[model samples]
Target: MIGDLLLAWISEAGNGTIADFRARAAWLARTENLDLHESATGRWLRDASALGHCEVDWKHGKWSVAPPVITRLPLADGLAVLVGARRQRLLRAIDEEGVYAEQARRLGSSRDIPPPCTILMPYERTRDLEEYAAALGAVYSGCAAAAIAALLGTTAPAKPTAPPAYDSPFEHLSSFSPQTWAPTLPSRPNPSEGLHREQVNGRWQHLLRREGGWYATDLSRGVFAELARRGETVIRWRPDGDHRTRTGTVIVDWGASLPPLQARALVLCSGFVPRFGSAAETSLYDNVPREIAARVASSLGQTLQTSS
Candidate 1:
């Protein structure tokens, strides 16, 4: 039950995809308040670990639940999600394959139940049919997964994949390079936006929601922060406008690259500055501060230009 509870806590923290020590400690304090008073709490953790219900990452000091065995089956022609009984047969079929499959139920588990099935494919607008499921049948599982067989498979032992690759969302600023990237502006919007509580992946993160947009991943934000530091600027969007419209997260276009960014971002070299927005006077050529422009280029924030 401890393992089950711990896994749930971990999952709930980061999009339910990851759990760290601080989160675990906090979760323990919250759910097992009585356990804290007992010295045997440590022994319980040891026992849980010995049973292979979970594993400890010593260096990082975190615990990780096993991830589901994702057996990729082409459902539709485009990406569509499966829900309810609509997702059952395929799940059962996959489960019958072997022990590596994840189960939907378990013992010694009061809270966390493993995911039954997860399918990703293109949507052809005809996926709901039972015939459709049987027709396009080239499914296989190549990923290293856990739960090792059983529909009642209780524990998920595999670790989640590493943080996604970093792609800067500020990749579009290269177009204005020939110019001074603009000379000046009346006010500059602060970049960091002063860290706020944000949900990332499936967990509670203290990062901004500059994302959910393609370029707003943690890696991108961190890179943006670094680049901003170099140029002494932070990468952020213009949150305020006449309509009070919420600009969805900032994004960099698909084909944009880094060279142009380097040219425009380097202060010492032949680079152009970036133009960002602010509270007071919005400038025609919003020259982003050196700090922020540098961060955008270096971090690859991949910010795009909107129509004037």
Candidate 2:
């Protein structure tokens, strides 16, 4: 039960440091009779990390976990993960394949018909039907579940909720060029106007929210126009107009509910040198010319623009 609680916490938090887990465990112990200590939590994390259930940073004491991706496997391999009444049901499904063959044929190519193992793998990996479908490349659509349903002769699961336009606070920042003026924008809003403006040096300089954070801008109409042209929602202040008020605030909404990028992107974007065990294994960014990185960055910008 403690192990289950730990996994649940990791799933909800996405990532956390050892201290974070320890504190959370303590709280759970007090409120929920979860009686796990810091040492127990640490041991469980280490074991899970060793088993490839999660990634860990020993030095910094941070760990992260993602839902497992679906991989092709045979029945023997599949049964190693499935159990209980579901296991018996899967056996029945596979045994009755001949009965469903005609039904499966009407759905699509017989060759594309997923096995009982395919249906069971999702159940073994996660209880989240959407995550299961997504791992099988169905995304929010019910296509993956439909395939499994055709095989099992059951109704397909409902389609997942549509993802939001922007998911992360960092996403809007990543849209701009890494080295450009846009990437330097400030995230801290001005207390008085609730805008990205601050008194810097001796002048009241305007700041824009960009790639990494807030950056100083000239506050030119042209700059606002350019940002708007780039598909950013720019709320301009009108002191004496209908949109004006001392209490008016600018709200920046991060859209699109996509999952955060994995550690590889975090490492590369932060300029970290990743170490691999074998000399033969090399980082993708290693020995690559700066031009390649720049080209990739430009392509990302283009993709964001197109999506917007």
Candidate 3:
């Protein structure tokens, strides 16, 4: 169940423990289609701990879930599965019906389809953290909520003719405007550096050696842009081969989406900067659908770069 995944993640976190995991918990709740406020995260964690799923030690500021040595315990019904199923059925029907209808009309259906470009949420005043967080989670929330709302069709948040800009969600995020929005190439590193792997988005991505000589990711431009925006200078990410990457000296946690780029960029709650760069010009992960791009960037620790 979704809740199980959330708990499992926390349990599998560094040292199999989570210290001060509020923001990430909030974001996870949204993705699971739970209308949970940030404050609710603690209650949820406590409830899970009480249920014998995890151990909560507030004094030490940690939540720990010790996996069963031999057996997996079943969890209760997590959320509204009926709603999720219905949405999936609807999407399938839409595609099937559209294809049949098009074929009847003697039109061809392309196997490769660019999803309908509809704004799920447009520019709106930051009324509250929930709304802002929801916007960031429009895609992440899946069919349980955000995607469901988008499928039902909603009005754009801003005027159709003019797109909108957004405030960076983090107070520490960079606020300076660039003389030129274009990315400055990442600084060079010593010749010893090379491509390495790092744990990101629940998986691993390569930290590549850039032309500038520094070991960074393929999407370094966007990552750097997000860091500068947040006024951050260093990325404390885990690389497969680097001892520093494994050390707790620096830790990264994915936060809310990059408001300016939405899912195109996402911040790490711990660092208050982007976890990966999102490519802008190409349709790829550097060139792919927004959803796929986000996943690829997550696995690889990068997203496409775009300007505000």
Q: In terms of lDDT, which candidate is strongest?
A: 2
Q: What are the per-residue Cα lDDT tens digits for candidate 2 across 47-80?
A: 4442233576654568886443222212222211
What C-alpha lDDT, on a 0 to 100 scale, does residue 196 get in candidate 1?
Answer: 27
- Tens digit of per-residue lDDT, candidate 1, span 141-199: 32111111111111111222232224312121212112111212112233222222233
Candidate models: Cα lDDT each? 0.29, 0.32, 0.30
Ranking by lDDT: 2, 3, 1
* TM-score for each candidate, following the candidate numbering: 0.20, 0.27, 0.22
Better of 2 and 3 by lDDT: 2
Q: Estimate candidate 3's RMSD in Å.
A: 21.7
**Deviation in Å, model 2, residue 283 alpha carbon:** 34
Give the backbone clash total of model 3: 19
125-157: candidate 3 lDDT, tens digit per residue? 223223333322211222221222123311111
